[model samples]
Target: MFKNLKNDLPASIVVFFVALPLCLGISVASGAEPITGLIAGIVGGIIVGAASGSKIGVSGPAAGLAVIVATAIGNLGYENFLVAVVLAGVFQIILGVFKAGIIGYYFPSSVIKGMLTGIGIVIILKEIPYFFGIDKNPEGDFAFLQVDGENTLTELLKVINALISGNFDYGATIIAVIAMAILLLWGNVLSKKGKFFQLVQGPLVAVVIGIVYYFLTKDSGLELSKDHLVSVPIPDGLSGLKDLLTFPDFSALTNPKIYITAFTIGLVASLETLLCVEATDKLDPNKNVTPTNRELFAQGSGNIVSGLIGGLPVTQVIVRSSANIQSGGKSKASAVIHGFFLLISIVTIPTVLNLIPLSVLAAILFIVGYKLAKPSTFKAMYDSGWMQFVPFITTIVGIVFIDLLWGIGLGLAVGIFIVLYKSFGNSHFLHKEGENVDDGKIKMTLAEEVTFFNKASILKELDQLPENSFLELDVRKTRYLDNDIIEILEDFAFKARERNIDIKLISERGIIENPDSFIEFFKLKKPTE
Candidate 1:
């Protein structure tokens, strides 16, 4: 791991920058302390990464779980919810031990596409408030499309109006803009040519700029509220650790509602982690496959640690994972190292971290979101296949129009429908084998399992069977023949007796005792043969 430090350090720094905003944003979105996100990121990197068997997977506070966490807090109270998170982790570990990791594989590719696209769209929408300095609760909190007199677009319009009409604080706005500018400059402009800029990230730069700007603009008597910037309580001295550990009252665990919250968190967090891990693996340059079982275990441990420490539940996150990969991470070491970095930095330099401007973080996420929702992404999905394109678009629309899980669920449903439609449709094989028009042989083999979809084609082929000539109806490979097709074969078999047609079925799983039902299955009203 040390040997890869040269590569890992740069990747770690990039991941740290990428994770900073998401950690804070997702936590805020979950109605938890912004520090909870940071704490999750730290544990994800340090503990989860170390324990994880996945080579390149990075874990953190997941946006996918933001809604679940938020609702849990609202329903069960924050204190009780913390206990649920710990329990969720325990559940995940049990799942991993059972080798349930392969469940991630069952999620359709289309659904996965939809998930990534949805997340991309959601990131952009949620960050809009931050980009303009409207200063909402947090970016991830936009799960339900907060009830305005109108809708999301209208509320967003109001936020825009506030920004334009000077209803928003200019001090925060100016500093945020400066932070964004600095970060962008360093990322897109300066980092290419310099070592220091590469060593330090644009978000950190924006944060530093925010601090400098804050001090420089303090005398302006701006209406900037503390809520606009980073807001973790900075306790004094080593004694501060006491406040970090938040204990949940487990006495109420017997409540059905608490159990419901625990199950919800466990399931949602697991799904998110699985999805993000898959996406991140795809995004990884090396294309390394992470061990899903160990990923679950790591997440479970991280959540357990986080719950005990007043932090948020954790999951593998694509945003930070992609950043880790693009920044050139070599192994899990970079991820583990970043965890320590987060822990040490927050503890030793809380005042410094608090200086990070929201706008600058927005700028950072703005880049991440762009990479995700890029125009090319749509083109790529469209090029993949109809199944891929459908769910991919649905996911994007769902997240943009409703919520993350809703979009993914809709996409998942569509994807599953496509799969089942194909499976049921492929139950049998269609053949056009009669004395050929050109060479005396035309066989259009149908699938093993035929359905109504193949009926038209099969009927067409059977109609063209040479009259009183050499006709071979081969059903050797077919397993389960649809009733409609079975009837067609039955009629054909009876009609072939009137001609010189020969029927043959070559299937191991096909009907042996009831081979006669092969034709009766279709039961054509008028046997043309």
Candidate 2:
């Protein structure tokens, strides 16, 4: 654990910076106290991160949960929401017990890649507000658009209005710009040198600068600006702690809606986690495989704790987890350590956290978004194969135009369509190369069950057989043939009479089903030849 701790601590700090804004944003978007996001992050990091089997996956409250969380809070009240979270955790654990984690593995490579790139595109679109000092919600959109607006473009306009009217705070903008500058410098310049500078990460730098910026603002007696800063609730020592606790309503468990809600959240969160894990692995220079089942179990544990503590349910979120791996996280320990940092920061210095600028975090996420949906990513996908390129590109567009799940579903459906079309059209269903004559005879083998789709190739093969040559149609292995093929055979037999062609059926049992004409044309029952 110590060895693991060594590697995870640095990675954890990077993850912590990435995670902090997200925690606040998701909670605010969910209509819950921003502190709830921190609670979820703490549970996700400490319980899920520590218990998780994935070596590098970092857990936290997911933006994907914002819709459900918001809806649940509105419909069931916040206390009842806790019950759903616990129930969702239980379902996730059940999924883990049955080894349903493999479901993630079954998704096509194209679909998974598509899902990640799509999420990246959505992140980029949604974060435009924060980047420009526009504060709607950091990055939460379900069907499309935000609660206060429609589309990223509309939100940007709102931000412009906020900025021009002297409504937007300038202090955070200044700090955010500096944080971004430091972030850029850290990744591009400072990281190259194997010196004291390399030891410090950019997000950490942004965080430190944010603290100083806050101090400067506070000392100057500037007006409070939630827009310019991280706005998560910070309890004042013991009293704030008391206000945060909540008890679940057991009666809510009796609501069937709770179960449906639980399943939807559990299933979606798990899928998002798996998608992030796959994308993160690809981003890894080492190219390691993640244990998906263990990840589900870990997420389940986190959700359970999160629910108990009045936090939103958690998952292996890619935005932060990817940052961890990119920052050179050596193991899951990094993820676990980050959880501790979140807990300590909230418990000891949440007031300071509120001081950190949202713009700084936006800059960090912008970097992440760029990495995910880089122009090069599209080029690389195009180069890889159509099986990958189509779904990946479509997923990005779909996700951007719609939401996370819809985009993934659309891309996956297209991918499956391609797979099935290829499966049934030619490769496995028909034997083409074998149709050429062998010593004046052609043999065509029928699959165990021949459907109407087999008619084209079968008829084409029959037509190609030499006018005077013998053709052996084997149905011994076949159990069923569609009527379309039977009709084609019946028509061909009539043609054979004029062409002096010899057609033979080789089967242990006589033909039981065919066109009525075909049945009458071959009147001899069971000609045992």
Candidate 3:
């Protein structure tokens, strides 16, 4: 790890810049203290990073869980919510021990792509209000309907209305525009000029510029207020830091609601973590595969520690992980270093951090959102075919209109429906050369493996066979046949004789003459000479 410090150090700095605002934003969105988000980030970096099998994936408080955390906190109280977080961590550890990580593999590729795209759209929509200096809703809130009795579409209209009525904050708009320009220039031009520019990072520069602009315009009409900047609890000393931490109420263990909340958090956090692992692995240039079970164990440990220290639940987050990858992170050291940065910055420069404008962070998130939901992604999915395109689009629509889990469920449903449709239609092959069924020979070739899904198609084909027709039932290529199909064939043999139809049965074992039952014939295999 030390050998790769040349690359990891710079990557860690970039990831730190990207994660700082997000940690604060997600905490506010989750209805937790900003300090809680910072604590989670620190634990995720130092503890989880040390324990995780992933080389590049970063863990923290995720925006996807903001709604769940907020609702759980409201229902369970903050102390009880911490209890739930601890229990959720225990649950994740159990899942890891049971080797349940394979469940991530069952999700279709199309659905995963759809999920990434959906999240990107949500990020763009949620950040637009912040970009315009409207702070009615918390940063990182991505639900279609908001806690403030407004929806995504209405929020956009509110921004537009503010602009038309001159209710917008020019300070925020100017800072945001400047921040975006700097980020674009650094990424496209300046960063390419030298390692120093890359090490410093565009987002860090944007943040510093935002702070400078805040002080420069303090007495002007374009001054940004405290509400428009990052807010970290400034503690005076070790005693003040001690007061910032909150412990879980062990008394809540008996409450059924606590258990319910714990289950919800565990399920959602595990899913989001698994998805991030998949996405990050794809982003890794070396194509390294992270151990999913180990990741779960690491995340569970981090959440336990975080909750004990008054932090929000932690999960592997794609946003930070992607930043780490894009910034040239070579190992888990980068993640660990970023965590230390979060820790040191909050403790050492809380005053300076509080000066950075929220508009600048919004601009940074806008770039992240665009990269995730690029238009080219949609075209590529469409080019893959309707099977991929349908689920991909459905997931995006569901996420934009509904919620993340609901969107993934809808995409999975569509993917499963497509599979069933294909299975129902392509179960077998029927060939008949002549038009007259009475004279022509009918050949029914069974698929490689016939299941109950093919039962309907098989029955229909059998019923349409002409009386006195010569039918050949072929199962030479079949490896396994469902019991229902075997019964169907057995029952058909008796009925075929009644219709004066001559039927020949073919299989790898050999031909059967007037078999009484397909099951009996298969069970009575001849011994080798």
Candidate 4:
């Protein structure tokens, strides 16, 4: 892993710069202490990076889980939420052991795109209040409803009111605009100018500028207060640092809600990790495919360690992983090195870190959100046709109006329905050219895979055949013929005889003229067991 120090070492610094603001920003978004995000970043890098199969994939506190973490903390309390993170690690370990990493493949691409877009929209909405400097408990809940008797839309309304009344924080707003402008210019323009610009990310620059802005504008009307800046509790020494660490509340083990939150975190984290792993592998110059089950185990271990020390849930994050790859990372050593950087920064520069404006972080997240939900993405999905567009749109609306899980669930439900509907219509092919209209003969070829879902379509075709017809039932290409379908054919054989219809059954085994029963024919030699 350390063989490529010349390349990996430099790449690690770039990844560190990329991950720093994200860790802190996601923490604030998740309603957790800033230190918790840093802790998760540390564990995810050192522990998960060590255990992961991928040579370059980076792990950290993910923005995708910000909404869930925030809601969980609000509902279960931070201590109880820690218990969930621990249990979530256990669940992820179980999923890895059971080789359930393939679960990620079952989700339709449309649904996944929808999930990302929905989360992106929510992030933009939640961060707007902070961007405008109306920082009222910037816990960053993305849910439509909040515990403070206000919801996302209501809060947005308040921001509009603040704007109309000219009562917003001018200082924070100014910093945010500058920070955003820098991020935009750095990412879109400067980064293309040279390698130095690529190695030094926009978020880090925005954060440093925000700190400088805070110090320079102190005591002025445009000065941002502590509430508008990051709030990292400074530790005095070794003992003080240890005192800052929080442990899971074991008493919460008896609480069912803790288990529910754990399962949600585990499931969602696993999904996100698997998706990032796939994307990172694609981005790899060597095109290496990480062992997904091993990746799950590594993430599980990271989350366990992170939770034990008051950190948000950890997952393989695409942003950090992509930055690592683009910066010439050649091995996991880069990831481990980045973790040490995070640790050193917190230990040596807590005061400087605390000066970073929350508005600046909000601006960084604004770019993140925009990338996830680009207007072109929606247009492309719409162009993909209704099969893809329906579930995609459904998921976005569900996520915007409801919660993260509900949105994915609704999208999956719609996807499944669409699949079933198509399955029902495509049960078999009745060859037009093969039809002997003068003799009332029909040749029907069964689909490659016919399940019970195809029963209605197949039955309708069979019933519509003319009386005294010669039916040629072909199953040569059928790899899977469900028992339900066999039974349907068995029943139809009896009706065919009464209607004076002669049935010819063709299979890989042989051809049977007027088969007495399909159940007995295919039952003895099923195409696929």
Number of the predicted model whose lDDT against the real structure is largest: 3
Name the regions of candidate 4 deviating beyond 4 angstroms: 1-34, 54-58, 61-84, 248-268, 275-288, 317-338, 425-529
lDDT of each: 0.70, 0.72, 0.82, 0.80
lDDT of 4 at 367: 78
Task: State which candidate, 2 or 4, has the greater TM-score.
Answer: 2
Which residue pairs collide, candidate 4?
none
User: Residue 44, candidate 2: how far off, in angstroms?
Assistant: 0.7
lDDT of 4 at 398: 89
Task: Tell me the deviation in Å of residue 512 in model 3.
Answer: 42
- Which sequence of candidate numbers ranks them by lDDT, best first? 3, 4, 2, 1
| Inter-residue clash pairs, candidate 3 | none
RMSD (Cα, Å) of candidate 1? 13.5
* Alpha carbon lDDT at 191, candidate 3: 89
**Candidate 2 backbone collisions, by pair:** 8-334
lDDT of 1 by residue, 1-529 (tens): 5678877887887677677767876787777777788888888999899999766778988776776777888888888998898999999998899877766755655566566666666666666677667755555443546422234576578778896787866676676666667766777789898777777767666666667776676667753456666665576655785676677778878888877887888888898888777677656665455778888888899889888777888888777777777666888888988888887777787787776666666666776677677888788667555655887788778877877778878887776676576565453455444346764443445456664345455655766677645444455555545443554466556566665565555444443322455533332221111
What are the runs in model 2 whose C-alpha is more than 4 Å off? Answer: 136-143, 159-171, 214-226, 238-242, 425-529
Q: How far is each candidate from the true structure, as Cα RMSD in Å?
A: 13.5, 15.2, 14.5, 13.7
Error of 1 at 267 (Å): 1.9
Q: What is the model-wide C-alpha lDDT for candidate 3?
A: 0.82
Quote model 3's TM-score: 0.79
